[model samples]
Target: MIYRMLAINIDGTLLQSNGKLHKSTKEAIDYVQQKGIYVTLVTSRSFPSAKKLAKALKIDTKLITHRGAYIANEIGRPTHSSRIKEHITYDLVRLLEGFPCQIRLVHEQFSLANKYKLNHKLLSKTVFTTGDPIVYSQQFVDSIGDTIADEPAHPLSIEVYFEYKEDLKDVQEAIGKMYHEVECIALNDLRLDIVPTGVSKLTGLLYLAERLGIKRNQIVCIGDEMDDIEMIQACGLGVAMGNAPFEVKRAADWITRSQNLHGVAYVVKEHFRKQPQIEFLQKLNIIK
Candidate 1:
């Protein structure tokens, strides 16, 4: 089948484990855009961070950021957004403060984070490296509640990082019971993103697909985390990195090399080489 678009997850699929984009990955993206294929980053990263990476790749395609809560190619102009109400955001921040976790109020313009301290250093949980720090840095405040009250926050989503596994579970349960309109999504074992009930990367990609006139089977989604599973399953060719968890690999249509091995570059080079033949359109239900 002819794939018309590629949706990439920024963290594990696009960037290597060292948190850097490989030269080959950059070239591969450039190559796809040259082929008239739409490329977008469907990530949980905030807009500034996602925008930073997109700019590096030299692609102006719209980005799906904030765990699918917001989508836009530019700041202050969103084609779609499902932001948590300021009041809900306030309440969620208050709820998160009770646990020993770091909380970030994510928005397109700025990010507000609390000064929560974890006694033990959790792996990769303490640092917010999803985006370029210099481009979109967090302003640490003693009390996020107070800061938001001073100027009400318009957050697309709230990110929580935990030191204890039990705390993560507890917060999930509490948020589940306290807010039915919002949902807690586990991006990993220690980090969770709270977004509107129906928002997800899959929903975000679907919106982009419809806007771009692309079908489900014409899209290729590559991701390596739990949050990526939905988009991976819903797209035409689901690709999982070699370093992805077994479950993620199982749910994917194919597995490529790990992040360090230039997984994304490999997929683009192999799959996008073929153009859909006219006869295959009938078999793919595209010409019925």
Candidate 2:
């Protein structure tokens, strides 16, 4: 089948676990673009962070970021943004503050966050995919809820990070019980991106695809997290990394090599091929 668009997740699908983009992966993305396929970076990362990576990849297509709450291009102008209502943002921040996890209210222009001291090992996870503080306006305050009350900020999403695995689990369960308007997505064990109820990577991609006049069956999605399962199931081709968890792999149409193993490169090379026109084949008397 012919695919026109490739929507790939960043953390575990494109970039390696070590947070580096491989040379092979870059070449593969370039090769795919030459084939006239639109490659979109669909990720839970902040738009600024994702834009920085997009620049490195030389991706000009608009990006899906903040777990699909914000869709923007490399220039940082969003064509779409689903911000949590100010009241809801305040309530969610209030609830998240009860836990030990750090909370950052993510927006297209800036991020408002609470300062939580975490172990050195867990600190990298917070900074790596979220954004560089210097590049992005990441303002740390005493209380995010207070900031919300004072400024009435409407954020695209709320990012939470935990030092302990159990805190992540507990917050997931707590949010599940308390809020009906927000979705708590676990990008991995240490992080969660909570967005407005209807916002998700799949929904965001579908919106973009519709705007571009691309059909659902003409898209290829590759991801490695629970939040990724919907798009993986909905797309024409769904790919899971070899390093992906068992559940994510099970939902995919095919499994590629792990991120560290140049999985994106392998998938593009193996699947993208020249399609023979039926009329041309018939004219050559190859088949009926």
Which candidate's TM-score is highest? 1
lDDT scores of the candidates, listed in order: 0.86, 0.83
Task: List the candidates' TM-scores in order.
Answer: 0.90, 0.85
Per-residue lDDT of candidate 2, residues 70-136 (tens digit): 8988445688888888887887788778877788887776787787876648565445456756567
Indicate the residue-level lDDT of 219 in model 2: 93
Give the clashing residue pairs of candidate 2, or none.
none
Estimate the Cα RMSD of every predicted model relative to the unseen true structure.
3.3, 4.1
In model 1, the Cα lDDT at residue 203 comes to 96
lDDT per residue for candidate 1 within 96-195, as digits (tens), equals 7877788888777678888877666564446675456787767889989888888887677888888888988888998898888889888677888888
What TM-score number comes out for model 2?
Answer: 0.85
Give me the runs in candidate 1 sitting further than 4 Å from their true place.
123-125, 276-288
Clashing pairs for predicted structure model 1, backbone only: none
